[model samples]
Structure formats: structure tokens, C-alpha cells
Target: MRYWLLGALMVTAGASANTSLFNLLNTGDRVNPVAMMERVETDHPGYIADFELDVQDGELRYEFDVINADENTLTELTFRATDGTLILQRNSKLEADDHDELEAVKLLDRKQLRFSELVRMASEQHEGKLMGAQLEHDLGISYLEFKMVDENGKRKHAFDIQKLKPLPMLQWER
Candidate 1:
């Protein structure tokens, strides 16, 4: 029941290793990631468990794992990043005991910064493109993780938005 890292959980579920941050725009009109997230959350109506913006199947995509405590299920949704079109959806039923995930969501709810606010702050940092963003927890503490790439190179960073702190820099083995 304890998650060592979100990326680990993802890998076990057959997620790709090509998670390095990159430009989401590819041959179509520029799609705003924040807008895609908002629209996906609205259409799916669940607590975000994991969210990612990365290139998948040779195209940019926004992938989400949304948890519905009421139904005790987690839905994985993938949308085309260039046009905000739903490309894939899969729902996995959760164990009855795992409904406690609401508690994890509440932990993030108590944070000082709202998700959108923190995302913008992360996007504006150091002239890099924000490739992915998600809430990650460790030992009951929750924070937002941002995967980015800039003139330097790919970077993975954790921001304690709850405390309004910057770059706690997590060491995820890639």
C-alpha cells in the first residue's frame, strides 16, 4: 500500500521509459497543457492520481490516472496533446480497502498553493518547458513534481508548494 515513487508505480503498469521532458507541440496548433488538464478533469470527474505530459507513440500526449473514490476505481486516460482529443481510456477497479485514497487527496488539498498556481510557477522557472506534472507522496507528505527540460538538459524537481519552497530536487533513477 506504500508507494516508493510514482515513476515506479508507472513502470509496473507498463508505462514507457521515454518520460524525459520535451516540447508538447508537434505539427498541429499549440495545445496548452493546463487547458488540457482542466478539460480532462472536468470530463472525467475524479481526483487526479497521476498526470503526465510526454510524447507517446511518436506523438505528444497528456496521460492521466484519475481515482474515483465513490466507485473505488482508477481510470487511465490519454489525450492527444496537439488537439486535446481523447485517445485512450482504461479503468481498473480498486480494492475496497483502497478507498482511503481520499485521504491522500485531502493531504494535497491542504496545501497552501492550488495546483494551477503551482504549475504556472513551475512553468515559469528558468526558461524551460514543463513536460509533466503530478502529485507525489513520500511517508505521508505530498508535493508536486515537475519534469522539465531547458538549455541545460532534462531535470526532475519537487516543489514544496505547501510551504512555497522551490526545487527540493528528487533523485529518481531514470
Candidate 2:
């Protein structure tokens, strides 16, 4: 009887622990929010707000807000790549005069190439000097960014490719 009670208690504790949001966020095999944001910035070179992640009903989601150059707040929703599903979403407004502009150029359009294609092109263009490349799609637009080390080994170059449209085809003029 004592063994049975102990086992029952353990099971109950495990169930409750799994349901706890903080515990799940800390223990899950997910990327750290700060590190993820840094990577996003390194890859895209844009301003981002802090975010939180949670698992709900077996799906992982993320929520955050981004401040545009114009200081407008744009809510961001991200789902976990481990399982393709809606993880979480955040919607909020920015205060007036909070905008900051960034330099991101549009390279290709949605109808011209797929996400994978952009990554491939960027990677191939950089070739042996290429360090890494990543692709991000937000607000129905895709951005292909890459990083590479300079010849002097002291500087790193990050490229941001955005504005992929369909009408007049635009190709990367390497």
C-alpha cells in the first residue's frame, strides 16, 4: 500500500509540473528567448522586443512585439518548428514617437522564389566565404539574410534581403 501511494504521488506531481508554464519554458528542449532574439537580429538586423514562449496542448508558441522604425508596435506570433502549429500570438499598440528605421532592402518577391530558394541563392553566392544564412518570413514577406567573415578576419558582413514581389521580376545581381 505504501508503494502504491508513493507511485500515485509521483504521477500527480509530474502531471502538475508539466502543466506549469514556467517549468515548461525552462525545461523544454527549446531555444532560449534571448539567444533566439539575438540570432534573429544577427540574421535580420532589426529591432525586436523581448518575448515569451509556452506550450499549450502539446503545441509550442511564442509571443512578442516589434518596434518598427516609425515606432509602431507590431505584434508577432511564432509557432515552434518542432511541430508545425500556432504557438501563441501577441497584439499590442506602440506609443507615439517610438519608431526607429532600419536599412533592409527588398531583393525578391513572393512569386519569384520560395523561402528555400532564397537561402540557397544567398549561400551559393557567398560560397567558401559564407558563414551562415537564414530565412525569415513576416507579414507575408520573406527576408533572406547571410553572414560572412571579411578577409581581414576582423569584420563580419550581414546581408538582409526583403521585398519579394511577383510583377516585375527582380533577381539578385550578385
Candidate 3:
């Protein structure tokens, strides 16, 4: 009963959609997201292509997807929020079939907007608890993708990497 309430609060109490995640997760006392991200980068040689900080079933966690171009591999790592301990790691080789995605990730270096800027721009007209973000592309057009949740459930907010304008929202399920 307590867990359910805690989960719901964590879900809905994100201080609106445009706010920074440093304020959304309220992790100042429990975890240091920057340090956690640094730890992930140090242990794995790659750039974080995707990231999320969320509470699921009452457990706080950090999820990161690292893309290593040299090794042509994509790695997913989850860390416990309380102590920044590695909880899980999944690695998969980026095959010839994944060339498009690999190239899209490489294009992130050309983005003119910062992550926080993209988040605020994506949420300016929409409202949802910001969950995570990723660098993605469709039909050769690259964008920064964000995951958000509200009473209506999870939805994606994307911004064009070149224009820095909000893209259409796409509804998705758990």
C-alpha cells in the first residue's frame, strides 16, 4: 500500500513538464546523477546515447544506453539510485543492420541545443513528468527523444536536432 502511493507520487510530482530533472527526481540527498553518469562513462568506453532516472516498483534507478563506435557495440546499464551501484549491464554488438542508428548517434555532436534546452523546448506546450532522453533518427533525420509520463501514461517528446523545435508527440505504453 505504501509502495503504491510512493510510486504514484514519484510519477506525478515532477513540478510540471518543463522543469529540470535535477528538480524532478529530487535526488540531491540520495544520488548524484552527474557522478553516476561519470561512473558509467568511466567503466564503459562510449558516449551515453540514452539516459533515464525513474522509480519503478518503488526502487530508484538510473538507466543509460552507451554507444561505442570503435567497438560497434551498444551497452545498457542500470544503477541503484541510493548508492550508485551497478545493478545490471547488457551489451550487444552493433551489426551491419544497425549502421543507420550508429550514424545517427554520431550526429549528436552537431546538435546546437543542450539536453536541458531540448527538454524545456519539447515541454513548453505539453505537460508530463520528464523521464528520460535519447538521440534518435528516422529516415535519416536526427532528433533528441524524450520520455514523459502523466495521468494519460507515457508519451514521447522529440525535438529536431537541427531546428531545435518540438516534434509531434507519440503515445506509448509501459
Candidate 4:
């Protein structure tokens, strides 16, 4: 019975040894997603709209979408999972929308309240680590929405891009 149990455990460990990057983080591996996100965001200096861990061409990679403060540029960065080295960088020009995202960005820039500023505020106000952030337009108004996690739990916060005031906490469904 002891040998059988040992053999089963070894098989389980072997099965999980080749798990993907997403599973490694989910299973409480050494790498922290928040820290990785912060590193990429700090190095890139833009609004981190989205991120994902996936295997491309048989290699694991972390993909991030960052939009510049002026809302005129969008950059996609991909990093290698093993060493966190940047493998790919692609920049594209964003078209001006009818709602004029650039105009809102310009107004925020005048007040020195860019996307990076909002990320700083979110980290401070929440008194926790930021997981991710995105700039969104609602009803012709721009808002900075962010998610954070600490001892309490995960929470979402939003700030009015124009006024730089914190909005009401969003009621999140588990």
C-alpha cells in the first residue's frame, strides 16, 4: 500500500510539472502576477488595458496591451515566461474616435492626471497592490478603472478621469 501511494503521488507531480504559466500562478508559484504586471506597466508607462498568459508557438508568454496617455498609440508587449525577457514589441496608431478619446486624454494631461497617475492613486487609496487597470469611456466621460487585492480581498475602484476623484465601489459578484 505504501509503495502504491508513493507511485500515485509521483505520477501526480509529474503531470503538474509541465503545467502552463497560468496554472503555475493559479497554483501559488514563485511568480506573482501583480508584481509582473507592475514591472511591465512601469517599464512601458501606459494604461494596461488587458493581459493574458498563453502558449504561442509551443512557448509560454505573457501578453499585455498598453495604450499611451495621449490615446494615439497602442502597444502590445510579449514577455518570455522563463526569464521575463521581452520577446516582442508591436506599436500601432490608434484612430481618433467620434467621442474623441484624445480630447479627454488631453484634458487629463493638462491637469497632470495621466493613466500612470491614476494607477498611483489607486494603489495608494486602496492600500493594496494593484492587479490591473484600464481607461474606459462612459457617456462621453473617461474613467480609470482598476482592480486590487490585499488581505481583505479583491476589490474594484474607479476614478473620474476629468476630476481625479474616486468613484463609488463597484458591487462585484463572486
Note the Cα lDDT for every prediction shown.
0.64, 0.41, 0.68, 0.62
**Which stretches in model 2 have alpha-carbon errors above 4 Å?**
1-19, 70-75, 81-174
Q: Best by TM-score, which number?
A: 1
Please state the error at residue 163 of candidate 1 in Å.
2.3
Model 3 has an lDDT value of: 0.68
Q: What are the per-residue Cα lDDT tens digits for candidate 2 across 1-25?
A: 9999999999777556434533444
Error of 3 at 130 (Å): 2.5
On residues 65-166, what C-alpha lDDT tens digit does candidate 3 reach at each position?
A: 888878889898998888888888999997776565566566654553334445556666766555787777787677777776665555676777667677
Off by over 4 Å in 1: 1-28, 95-103, 110-114, 167-174
- Candidate 2's displacement at residue 12, Å, is 13
74-104 per-residue lDDT for model 4 (tens digits): 7888887666888899998765552344445
TM-score of each: 0.69, 0.33, 0.60, 0.54
List the pairs of residues colliding in candidate 4. none
Superior by lDDT: candidate 2 or candidate 3: 3
Give the residue spans of candidate 4 off by over 4 A: 1-63, 68-71, 80-84, 95-104, 151-153, 169-174
Task: Return the TM-score for candidate 1, rounded to 2 decimals.
Answer: 0.69
Ranking by TM-score: 1, 3, 4, 2
Candidate 2 vs candidate 3, TM-score winner: 3
Model 3 RMSD vs true structure: 7.5
Clash number for model 2? Answer: 12
